[model samples]
Target: MSQLDPYGNQTPNRAPDSWVPDPWLDQPDREPAGEWPTRNGRADEPYTGSGDLPYSEAEAQTAAYPQVQPRAEADAEPATDPVRPRRPGPGKRRATGRAGRNLPAAIGVGVTLGAVVIASLFVWRPAFLAVIVVALGVAIWEMSRAVRAVGAHPPAVPLAAGGLVTIGMAWYAGEDALMLGFLVTLLATLVWRLADGLSGFGRDAAAATLIAVYVPFLGGFAALLAEPDDGARRVIVTLAAVVLSDTGGYVAGVFFGKRPMAPTISPKKSWEGLAGSLVATAVGSAILLYLLLDVEPWWGAVFGLALSIASVLGDLAESMLKRDLGIKDMSNLLPGHGGLMDRLDSILFALPTAYLLLAVFT
Candidate 1:
């Protein structure tokens, strides 16, 4: 019940609120209208009591607000409240395991491919050669597309044609013809790049030659394996050994692979997985060779060990290539498996190794 200050707040010696009526409501007289007061007779400058304010520059800046820091209790909520569950990753539901692949699709595709290989291989020799041709063609096409990213325009047509000739020579003609055909293909690839002009001739020719060697040259050994009367069995044993190695590695990598083998190249690969591959390959090779080729079981072990090491190297080499090319997969043609090249990576290395081993053992 006191009179107020200018802002309508009660002061120590003020009269009661009832005694002091509102000035704006009670007063009748008004001052004559005039221009508003300004600092230094300039409207831009706001008035300060003493001349120009010393902190005018600082005052011109917007007021800094203190950031609202998060509460410690909120961060500690997850630890204390056992009922609140953490969110899972996006792929956790669909992925089969830590590898993050659709396991069902991968297995189905693998079985189908294996069945096709066996059917063609045993049914007719020409049919198996046709299969090889088709696989190499697709691989070359994929590489052609992949290399374009690096400005290397490998001629896919000549590459495919040369691959056909190479595989045909290896299967029908003999080992000498195989060498002759490879040299011819290499020369053909060099000449093929000439049509594209000399802009990137060296680069393009190099890539094309690499494709020729990697795809068909290595694949010719498979044809070599199938040349003998008992050739089909030899090829089968080689395929089984490589497949077992991959399977054993995959299983072991999933369960016991804590230490990475080549983390920079393939993060999923581990030393423990490699151990599994060697054991599986060796054991499987021994059984298959003894049963099919009438060879000693120990020879099979030697063959398996060699093929396993080569297969791992092949896998790592392709991984390095893909990493260099800045691609995850050569193509998405094969769901769950990635590309034909991906499937053939280990096979390419294993084929030559198997051929060499069989030549020595048998």
Candidate 2:
């Protein structure tokens, strides 16, 4: 055997298995109190060095190349799938659909009912007048309902009295009767308010009183138009003027309109439409004058211009009311149209003006 190193390793001249004792281990007389190094060159104790401990073989392998998680399994829904079916182009009709599907059948019913009423008016004038009175009464009621819908407590008795007085004035008396009836209605409204202890009658009473005059009183002019002594012809002519004007305005505005007529109240109405309405009304009035009345062409032109302007004012008034009430339409009574109020608003003012003109001239 040859000599060896102080450690467990053999010297160059020693055999491979010949071991030597360590110098530190040979010092058995000293106390074992100090820290020692671990196999990876780190201190064995917890508070030894700043370096982190060596990882295990498994951890090192994992750190070398991380295992990526497979993508989550896709859902079975077609819309959510990665390879969804392509949508059809806008030009293509993927499914067959029914025409006239959205049209209201109620409009057809209303038209039929209106025809029956018109027929009854021609056949039996008395019965027609009575039905018209009732219709006006119902319209008054609806006006009251509208007032209430806007959170106002209208004086019901005064409103009903006003409506009745207006109807009576239309039936028996002339313009004098209308003035007297208005005076009586106003006096009665005040009296009724006092009788009710002035409890809830506030601005609502004032508004309701105004509505009574505006809706029923003005609307009663239609009855006056249907009276005898050329009243029927005048009424028909007036209606034709209003209708033709409205139609011409709507069509022209949609096609060639650029400037707004009343941007504050009715943004859709246009100056171009107003001009078209005047032109159409002039033409319609001339035709009616030649056919029905022996009036000059100038007279027809004058009437057309006046009636068109009045109709526009009436429409704007109604639009202002609706804007105040924060509503788009009065009701869904007419499909692709609006309510009776919407249709009759212009006619209401136009009829009375035409009647007065006929009374003066004809």
Count of backbone collisions within predicted model 1: 1
- In TM-score terms, candidate 1 sits at 0.75
The alpha-carbon RMSD values of the candidates against the true structure, listed in the order shown, are: 14.4, 11.9
lDDT of 1 by residue, 259-302 (tens): 99999999999999999999999999999999999999999899
Total clashing residue pairs per candidate? 1, 0
Instruction: List lDDT for all candidates, in order.
Output: 0.85, 0.70
For candidate 2, report its TM-score: 0.68
Task: Name model 1 segments beyond 4 Å from true.
Answer: 1-95
Clashing pairs in 1: 3-15
Q: Which one wins on TM-score?
A: 1
lDDT of 2 by residue, 179-265 (tens): 667667766766766666766667667766767777667867767767766655666688778877887887788788899989989
